[model samples]
Target: MTSWILGLTGGIGSGKSAAAAHFSTLGVHTVDADHAARWVVEPGRPALAEIARHFGDEVLQADGQLDRAALRARIFQDPAQRHWLEGLLHPLINQELLANLAGAESPYAILVSPLLIESGQHTMTTRVLVIDAPETVQVQRALQRDQVSEAQIQAILQAQASRDERLRHADDVLTNDRDLNWLQTEVERLHRFYLSLRGGRP
Candidate 1:
């Protein structure tokens, strides 16, 4: 709770998870907004109830679990639906993120969120670190990593904060457009930088 907070963000497929993994290896107290978002809407949760009420039972699977893919498709296609879903979830997710941050046990903690900029999660941190990559790279990475097509990926890109906007808000940027080794080196360099900022040696 007394540690510095680092808000780490990037657009979808910008290697946010990979960056988070590197930070984890360095013992950074890390909390993922995506994980928190999913956590807040688990099957028996009140957020799930609200989601079901707004999107209907078809949004749930036969096992009575929220069908994430179906909901993603719906929200991307309907701006109003997406807005409603965000309005219902962001507050709950924030609460979970704050709780996690408060429980962090490190010189600093990293809040990894894809929507850190778009959703104003950066306000909760002392600095913002963005993982940067080209737009085409992002689309290709998403196509390979996720079960979605180009169109769906494009829809997500359209809905997220742009590369420029994200960079504009970044206090630091970790470029992930090259090989994994390069990314790791960059991350380690930043990790040390963060430690130095905290008046410690990594």
Candidate 2:
């Protein structure tokens, strides 16, 4: 049977990962775009070749892999460089995401991507689910989890679509302002709704 592909997205530190985890517990197959992007550029992937061409060999470390720290520093220093990197990786990631969704044999598949709304990939899914949190909470969580300063968190958030923008684009919104138990309950409710979308009894 064709699986129902649900696009899961959220702001930075909005607990989208936790929501995806909850879906996994219900036997839903989940494909994370960030993880897929990393995998495609792993050893022996053409994405590495493209990376070398765009950013030069310096982006690769002695072990012949992308130096994430170096690349992050470079991109943050220049908006054009960051856009170039996204242009190269986004298409490849989308291709792989679609492939994984097509190959899924489960009742549904969750495409967990932070940029689902920004990248315009939400159109490929049956529904867009946003794991939302207030900007203050998001900034706080990001600062604590990533060990970055408030200024850094602000810059990151500024680059992303606002919480209001995300809500405007969402078919469903799972607020992550509360605790894990709340997150789990919201995910369960969504899981059941996803099943109903596929004409299955929840």
Candidate 3:
């Protein structure tokens, strides 16, 4: 049977996780690309060994797991390195994402990825939902949530698709510059809308 997949994405710190979690509360199964990305590079994974071989053991923590922050800094500063890393890991992550999504039993499943549009993952979905917040808000939120420097956050923002570009491709947009109550209400409204698209499944 065909699954109705919703592609959910947004800029870093745009409340995508919170929105997805709320959707979970309503029984929507959500698969996260970030989680898949990490899964592909777990300590025992071939991808992790390849990364260490290419970038040296510096990219690995003493415990043998990927040093995500070190690797993030390395790639963000070099476009060629970033491309190489993406080339290596994107396919693996995609495979895992597809498997998890295919197993979803919900009437409609959500694939949450910060790079959903950029990585072409949206092609797998029936609809694209963008959780949007202003750039300033994004920066502030990221600053509060991560231990990274402002410069590092700026680099990440630069690497991602521009805000307008995401909106241009979005089938639905959830503006997240507001409070949690507003977000929950919007999620419920969209949840109903998505169910209706599936003939209003209970």
So what's the TM-score on candidate 3? 0.95
Which one is best on lDDT?
3
lDDT of 2 by residue, 92-168 (tens): 98999888888877787889988888887888787788999988899888888899788777777776777888888
The per-model lDDT (C-alpha) reads 0.89, 0.84, 0.91
Q: Write the per-residue lDDT of candidate 3 for residues 1-202, one digit (tens) a residue.
A: 3358899999998999999999999999999999999899998899999999999999988999888889988998899999999999999999999999888898889999999988889888888899999999999999999988899889988899899999998989999999999999999999888888853232
Cα lDDT tens digits for candidate 1, 73-128: 89888999999889989989999999989998888899999999888899999989
Q: TM-score of model 1 relative to the true fold?
A: 0.95
> 1 or 3: which has the higher lDDT?
3
Among all windows of 10 consecutive residues in model 3, the one with the lowest summed lDDT is 193-202
What alpha-carbon RMSD in Å does predicted model 3 have with respect to the real structure?
2.1
What is the model-wide C-alpha lDDT for candidate 1? 0.89
TM-score of each: 0.95, 0.92, 0.95
Model 1 residue runs over 4 Å out of place are 199-202
